[model samples]
Target: MSRTVVFIHGLWIHSVAWQPWQELFAGKGYETHAPGWPGDKDTVAETRLHSEGAGVGVDEITDSYAKFIAGLDSPPIVVGHSFGGLIAQKLLDAGLATAAVAISPAPIKGIKILPLSLLRSSFPVLSRPGNRNKVVPLTEKQFAYGFGNALPPAESAELYERIAIPSPGRPLFEASSANFTKNAPTAVDTTRAGRGPLLLLAADEDHTVPAAVVAAAYRLYASSRARTDIIKYDDRGHSAAFDHGWRQLADDSLAWLDRQSL
Candidate 1:
């Protein structure tokens, strides 16, 4: 039987963000699906115009993705980025994913290390209280500082033009207030036996989810009986998966999946 891989994109970008990843995995004989979040548009331009995507929260996003995964013939290998990474972990907790990879995942409840860079990266969303119900778009300057700081200026600018989109602010607010919120949806049951093998990939220079943040998440999953590991790439930024060396990230994930025998 052929294995299936589900690619989950983070905020700002829609399912199209995973096109390259889908093709790469398809070339390796894995069937792939990249599902958009609820209210997601077909393209960045459309999403920017509509902007309702930012109103969706963690619970709604997780529930939507869980329903989609349930319809698959079998559990898929879930791979997610940023907020999608948080959703991947939630799916694994619910016994929906056979194995999982989370790249620069957003903070789940209980992760307390809020680096200065993370605060800066998230400021655009959190700065305005009303943004919880509004779409938040990143300026090129913010994108360059937060997602593409490690890339060359020209490449960073090109990437910003190609993939940047507006994101819902609610999820960021939820993540920021996770620890204080009652029954935060970002909380994961780290002790689930059937959660399966997991890998957390971090970009060493990522302004959003830095090595320290990734390490904290890995530590949370340490209690799991299933194998859990983390890999950090040097000099890469938060947008490593979409940047010039994205293939390396894909290859590393494939190699890790191979080790899991998934």
Candidate 2:
């Protein structure tokens, strides 16, 4: 029997966002399962309706996913994007995944990069005033810098259109802590047992998860025999999953997973 491919989407998206990847993967003799986060709805519209106040914490999302993964008859191979990539790492650490893929996974061991553009992109919602709970949409310029700086106008616009909702400020706030020490007790763990064959897909032009950040996470793998490879894309932006050449990421993932005999 074939192992299941469990997909965990990043912030601002639901399970349906992974449809394209799922369709492509299923065609290659693989089974696919993308589960929703704690407060994520079944569809994009509903996800938008969920609002910022209803957002799930990193642990909530991870633990909820853990329950779903645990019930599986066999450990499913896991894949994630951006924040979802971090979640994927957590799952792998927990020994839940057979193998894992992290596409533009955000900072874990603090990759060194002080790009103001990347920091400002998340500023809209991350550094809010008071306990304001609302989803703040990113401006066109913000979208371009934060997610699609390297992509053309048409591709960037399509991605901006799909920017369903804003992520919760708490995750970002905690993630931006003073060396994660202040938040480590509350944050999700990316260092766990099964840390299976791990693949880190780093987009070369990605503004959010820059080369430095991805490289840093790969370096801190607690696993002894962990296989981590960083695959760079010339024109792909932070919104790589929706980019025109997204097929390459999917194909590379399929090939890597195939190599693991999963």
Clashes of each: 1, 1
Stretches of candidate 1 exceeding 4 Å from the true structure = none
Candidate 2 Cα errors over 4 Å, as ranges: 52-55, 110-112, 129-136, 178-194
TM-score of each: 0.97, 0.87
Residue pairs whose backbone atoms clash in candidate 2: 93-192
Q: How many backbone clashes does candidate 1 have?
A: 1
Best candidate (score: lDDT): 1
